[model samples]
Target: MVIFSVLYPATPGGRFDQAYYDDVHIPLVKEAFAATGLKDVQVFKGLSAPDGGPAPFVAMVHLAFEDAAAMQASLAGPRGAEVSGDIVNFSDITPIAQVSARD
Candidate 1:
């Protein structure tokens, strides 16, 4: 599987509206990539580290696509623009993203 991941760092006093991410942003992502071979989506809310320390990140997202091409398409064109533009509505922390290939 090829996955696109966007991770929000846990910055001191940073703002991340989890409610908006779950209620609104996620749904928007779904609709935008529905036709781009989006297979599934997994959203993670960082709670704590193994030692119970602060989590390194506040949120993480994994979006599964059919392949590299499909993943690329998901981040291109008009739909991609919509997804990128929606970030400011929810959080202020810049997300770290990557594309990975998994077995």
Candidate 2:
């Protein structure tokens, strides 16, 4: 399995609507990528670091896919564009993305 993670770095005065992310954005992602072998989606909201300092990322989203090829195919389609464009609706932070294989 492949896990695609998108991390939103914390910034001073950053704005993230958690409600919208959970209620709207996530659903949109599921709808957009479900057919391309998307298996599951998980979202994390950052609270604090080990030292009680602010977390590096305000939020993170992990998407599970059947394989790398399936993930690539999903991203190559129009749905990818739609998903990417929807980011502005909830947050102002530019997300950093990573793809990983299950250990």
Candidate 3:
């Protein structure tokens, strides 16, 4: 399996609508990605840093796919564009993305 991650940095005045993200955006992601071998998804909400400071990121999402090729396919085509474009509906911060394979 492969993991595709999206992380949002915590800006001083960052604006994120968690409710909309959970209720609206995530469902859109599931719908768009499921057709391309998306297996599962996990979400994280950053609370604090190790030293008790605000976490560097406000939130993160991990999408699991059948394989590396499946991951790439998930991000291609019109459905991918639809999922990506929905980011503006809930957040102003640009997300950081990474792809990794399980050991």
Best by TM-score: 1
Per-residue lDDT of 1-103 in model 3, one digit per residue for the tens?
8999999999888898988989999999998889889999898999999999989999999999999889889898569989999999999999999998875
| Per-candidate local distance difference test | 0.92, 0.92, 0.91
lDDT tens digits, residue span 1-103, model 1: 8999999999997899999999999999999998988999999999998899999999999999999988888889569998899899988998999989888
Tell me model 3's lDDT, rounded to 2 decimals: 0.91
TM-score per candidate? 0.96, 0.95, 0.95
Output the TM-score of candidate 3.
0.95
Error of 2 at 53 (Å): 1.2
Backbone clashes in model 2, listed as residue pairs = none
Per-residue lDDT tens digits of candidate 2, residues 39-93? Answer: 9999999999989998989999999999999899888877999989989999998
TM-score of decoy 2: 0.95
